[model samples]
Target: MTSRTLPRLLQTPAVLLLLVWMLVPLGMTLFFSFIRYVLNSLRRPEWTSPSIDNWRGWGNYEYVLYSAKDFWFAVQNSLFIVGSVIALTVGLGLAIAVLVNRNFMGRGIARVMLISPFFVMPAVNAVLWINMILDPVLGLNGLAVEGINAIVASLQTMPIFGGFFSLWPEIEPVSFRATQTSAMAVIIMVTWQWTPFAVLIFMTSLQSEDQQQKEAAILDGANAWSQFRNLTLPHLARPIAIVVMIQAIFHLSLYAEIEIVSRGNGNKNLPYLIGEFASNNIGAASATGIMAVVLANIVAIFLLRIIGKSLMD
Candidate 1:
């Protein structure tokens, strides 16, 4: 075989596999989205199976966009969660990466401890955080508050400070399982699990920073902030953007953590909403799934452009 032909033959299987992987499910989702398919319908059982006879055109999409109560809420929540996670992980990652970049004793151990959280299963992370750390009555939050209140109560008995301490109201431990707090729980757990990933990436990028440039800046009397602003931030720009988009993609479909933390009680992102629709309304689910694809692609296009530019540089 000629070299060109041999290379094409070798690449064919992967290309075909990717095409199948991308198109087959997507095609089915598109078809189902436009048809009145569902898992259950007692009055009109014919609608239970997918058939071209029940084609819905834009009905499903309109239902999802305008009629479904959770559609906009889920979209907003998804963006909110992804945005918060990106902001937090990037900010904390920068500070931690800079602090730990320099060689120090026990640095390896520190790095291990720092990065370990990233490898944890999302469900386990959420469970451990919500149940073990954030539970109002049984977790550390409550215990810490209880301990503080105990200290204050003891202080109230002291003659010198009794009047001052007695005037303080009791503190309450926040129940993160509640409606408003559930989103906070998901955010905290996701941030804890992902910040380490950001740290690892940023730290790796920091190692490649130009030491000579930094030294020159120092000799030129550039302060730490000035050097960071002029040198490090510029160098980190692409990585920062990459990190934000990468985390955004990962968090957009966040499921296991939301399930474990809130179970869609007070918070549901887009993926979770799709899962809810998938239970009985296949048409709505498929339509929402298609919209999800569109949203992901929008973000991916911008991300790929940045990545491509970085690759060229």
Candidate 2:
């Protein structure tokens, strides 16, 4: 065999395996999506089976798009959480990475500590932040808020500042359990966990920066802020693009963190919404699954375009 033929032969099994892995479930989802199917029904139990007679055409998609209010909300919340986390992670990560990249005592240990959060499992991270840190009644959030209130109340009882303190209302701890703020809670935990990843990437990228250019800029009497904006920021453009793409792809399908923090308690992303539909209405769920795939493809294409442009520079 030719050299290229041997490589192709070696890769054939792996390629075929991956094709089966992806296409099988995708085919099933597509088929089920176009037919009427549900987990439970007393009338016309045949509706539960997967057959051409139950063909629904675009009815499942129509139900999801038109009848379901949560679908739009889930889409909105998903984008919101993803965007927030990306902004937080990239901003905080760049700052931390720049600080940690400097030469300082115990810098090695500091780097280790900074990156430890990224190594933690997502579920564990979610639970730790939600239960140990954010729980309104028992966690630091409640305790800190309660302590402030007590201090305010005590001040109100004092003669000198009693009137002034009485005018100030007591502060309330923000609750992460409610639907309105659950997505926010998810965003916080995910950011905390993923920021370290961004830091590590940026730190590696920073090491390769042109120190000679920085020295020249210094000789030119460029201020630190100017140097950073004109030189450092441009050098980091590609790394920033890569970090954004990876984080966006990962965050778009976020599930464990959301489930642990919110449990879809009125807050849901596409994945959680899909799970909800899958519990009974398999057809709708399948249709949602297909739509999710399409959405993911759209996002992936956008990211590729951005990353490609960055790399070309």
Candidate 3:
């Protein structure tokens, strides 16, 4: 056999195995999506089992699209949370990465501390943020607001500043668990956790940047902002694209954080919607899962195009 032919033959088993591993679940999900499958059904016993007799055609998809009120909201919320997290992480990561790139005292320790947040488990991160930091009554958020109000109250007792302090209204701590703010809570915690990931990628890319080019720019009377805007940003384009793509894929299906933060109160994403459907209606859950796969693919394709363009440029 030729050398390349031999290697291809050897790799065939692994390639086939991987394909089967991915395709099997996808096939099952597709099958379930087209049928009336559920865990328990007293009205229709046959619907509980997965069989051809329970065929639903596109009924489940129709139900999800037209009947289910949360499907569209979940889709919108999922995209919102993912987009917000990506924006925050990328911006903060770029700023922190650039700041830490400079030589300074305790640089090594600072790098370690900055990257440490990425190691926190997603569930744990959510719990900590929602309970310890963002809680309206018990968390640091409430304490800080309370402290500011207290200081204002004390100032209102003073002679000259009393009138000014009286004009200031009492500040109420925000309830992050509320329907309006639950999604923001998710975004904030997720951004905190994932920013370190972006930092790591950007920092590694920045280390490989051409120092001579930077020195030349400095000698040419370019300010720090000019060097960053022209030189550093261009050099880091590929890394930024990579960070965006990977984070988009990950945050698209966020579940643990959503569950811990809101329990589907007002911040339900597609995955959480699937979970809610799965508790009883397997067919609807499977249908949602299929749609989620499609959504993820569309996002990945869009981001891939951006990556490809960055590579070409």
Measured on C-alpha atoms, candidate 2 has an lDDT of 0.90
Which candidate has the top score in lDDT? 3
State the lDDT of candidate 2 residue by residue for 35-109, as single tens digits: 999999899799888888999999999999999988999888888998999999999988888888889999998
lDDT of 3 by residue, 1-313 (tens): 7779988999999999999999999999999999999999899998989999989999999999999999999999898899999999999999999988889999999888888888999999999999999998899999999999999999999999799889999989999987659999999989999999999999999999999999999999999999999999999998888888888899988989999999847779999999999999999999999999998898799788877776866
lDDT of 1 at 288: 97
In Å, residue 241's CA in model 2 sits off its true spot by 1.3
Clashing pairs in 1: none
| Comparing 2 and 3 on lDDT, the stronger one | 3
Residue pairs of candidate 3 with colliding backbone atoms: none
Can you list the residue pairs that collide in candidate 2? none
Q: Give Cα distance to truth, residue 84, candidate 3, Å.
A: 0.6
Off by over 4 Å in 3: 1-17, 302-313
Per TM-score, what order, best first?
A: 1, 2, 3
Ranking by lDDT: 3, 1, 2
Better of 1 and 3 by TM-score: 1
Measured against the true structure, the TM-scores of the candidates, in listed sequence, are: 0.97, 0.93, 0.93
Model 1 root-mean-square deviation = 1.2
Residue-level error in angstroms, candidate 2, position 59: 1.1
Off by over 4 Å in 2: 304-313
